[model samples]
Target: MEAFAVPGLPEFETGDDIATAIEAACDLRGDDVLCVASTIVSKVEGRTATLADYPAGPRAREIAARFEEQTGEERDPRFAQAVLEESTDLVMDEPFLLTETRFGHVGVNAGIDRSNTGGAELLLLPKRPSESARRIRERLSVDASVVVTDTSGRPFRHGQTGVAIGWAGMPASRDWRGETDRDGHELEVTVESVVDELAATANLVSGEGDDGTPAVVVRDWTFGDHEGSENLYRSVEGDFVRQALREWHYEQ
Candidate 1:
């Protein structure tokens, strides 16, 4: 499997045709998987907010005060307000707020990003990432798959890695149920998140800072037909970490 970036993309803006830009930047082939950063997708979809757009509300100020008091790290209330507005539920408030986004994604600050925006602007995750990927795939001339990716920190893990937020035209997970192992042992509960793996691999080529290459084309791999990254999400009831945290919060 080989992955390379589609370079020479100009700074994206609201209403820009991202599919056209991607096509212009790279020569796409059938069966290729395109991994695109969520920042560009948010930019094109007009999912950006400025300080002026999200003024600090009373709740924002309260949350900001609590955050600063706990972490001793000062943060802007307006930014906190923006994060709250983008989130469907707030799981934690101190250190960093772990929020469930409107799209059902649970992460820090509801995936409200401040980096890579010019100035005083915040980028939110795409309203519907799967739809965005599907649209981009339909617009491109070649038959290919698309995965919308974002940088995220994992629990009990240091540093950050790329994760698939949305995808189209390929199975997000490859279930190996009823298969055999090296010794012909029956395999169960061995589903692999191929989309996230591709996203993480593609990020190796699409650097986080100033690289200007937000999209990468991965070739030389075969994929089965599927849709979206919904299979990747764990329900709150079934998530041990979240359930434990909820119990701890209640006890506190």
Candidate 2:
């Protein structure tokens, strides 16, 4: 599969037609999957907040104080407040607050992005990324899939990598549960996150900083019809990491 950036997109704003802009910049084809950066999706959806919008509250100040003590860097109380407001739960307090977002995504700062946005503004993840992708796909004439992506740091990993936050027109995972492996061993748990793989591959062209290419078209990929990114999340009851972290936090 080949992924190429969709060029010539102007700085997007609230209410801008993303599908039209993408079609104008690239030669869209049937069966192509479009990997769109979540930042642009947030921008177009008007999901932005200024520092003034998130004044430091009691919880924000408490978290900020702990964060600063651990990092040795002054934490912006307003930023901390915004992170808390965007999160459903604060899973950690030191290093950085690992938060579970309203949409059930766990990450630092609830994926509230400060980079690439104009100064003094922060971009939140789209309220419903799968819905956003589906809308974009419906607006375009070509039969294609859409995957909304964001850069995220993995546990124990040094660098950030692209991950799929929302998707439409394709299964987020490919399950090989009943299939046999090369050694004829039945694959009980061998699901592949095809959406995330596509997002990471698309990021090869859509760089992290100043790339200006927020969207990419991936060609020559096969996918089954599926909707949403819910499959990408591990259920809370089954998440061993979360359970262990909760226990560790109580011990501390």
Candidate 3:
């Protein structure tokens, strides 16, 4: 399969149409998977915000003060308030703000972007990424799958890679469980995250900082005969790492 970015996409505005913009820029096939940067999706969805928009309450002020005292970096109470407002649960709050967004996404500072905000102070993620992907897919002329992607740091990973926060017209993963391996042994537990892998491939050509190519088309790639599954995020009840973190006390 080959992947290339769609060129000539302009700086998106609040009311811009992403589906039409991408459709005009390139010809997409039904089999092609379109990976879109969440930044552009949030831009067009008008998820931009300013720090002043969130008034720092007592809780926000406390969190900010504790953050500054522990990290030795000044923390803004309004910024803390913004993260708090965007999150439904705080996974971690000491060294950094690791929280679960409203739509089940877990990320630092609620995955708020400070860059490429179209002059706004912040760029919040789309309220519902899968819904955003579905909307974009329905607007397209062809039946292409859409993956709404974002770059994020992962546990035990040194740098950030593209991850699928929302997807449409396709399953999230290819389940390899119960399949035979190279040695003819039954594979008990193996699931390939197709959307995240496609998102990473898209990012290889999507460009960063000023590349202006936030959308990429991946052609000729197929899911083959593997069974598909839509299980990406882990539930707290089954997530041992999260459980340990919740029970373990921090030194600081």
Best by lDDT: 3
lDDT of 2: 0.86
Tell me the tens digit of each residue's lDDT in model 1 across 79-104.
89988988877777656788888767
Q: In the order shown, what is each candidate's alpha-carbon RMSD?
A: 2.4, 2.4, 1.1
Model 2 per-residue lDDT tens digits across residues 176-235: 667777899987766789989999998888999997999999998886543223488776
Report backbone clashes per prediction: 0, 0, 0
Candidate number that wins on TM-score, 1 or 3: 3
Tens-place lDDT per residue, model 3, 1-252, is: 999999899999988999999999999999999999999999999999999999999989999999888879998999999999999988887778888898888899999999877889999999999999999999999999999999888788798889999999999999888899789999977899999999999989985688899999999999888899988888889888778777765577
Candidate 3: minimum summed lDDT over ten consecutive residues — where? 243-252
User: CA shift at 233, candidate 1, in angstroms?
Assistant: 0.9
Between candidates 2 and 3, the TM-score winner: 3
Candidate 1: Cα lDDT at 90:
77
Residue 161, candidate 1: Cα error in Å is: 0.3
- Relative to the true structure, how large is the alpha-carbon lDDT of every model? 0.85, 0.86, 0.92
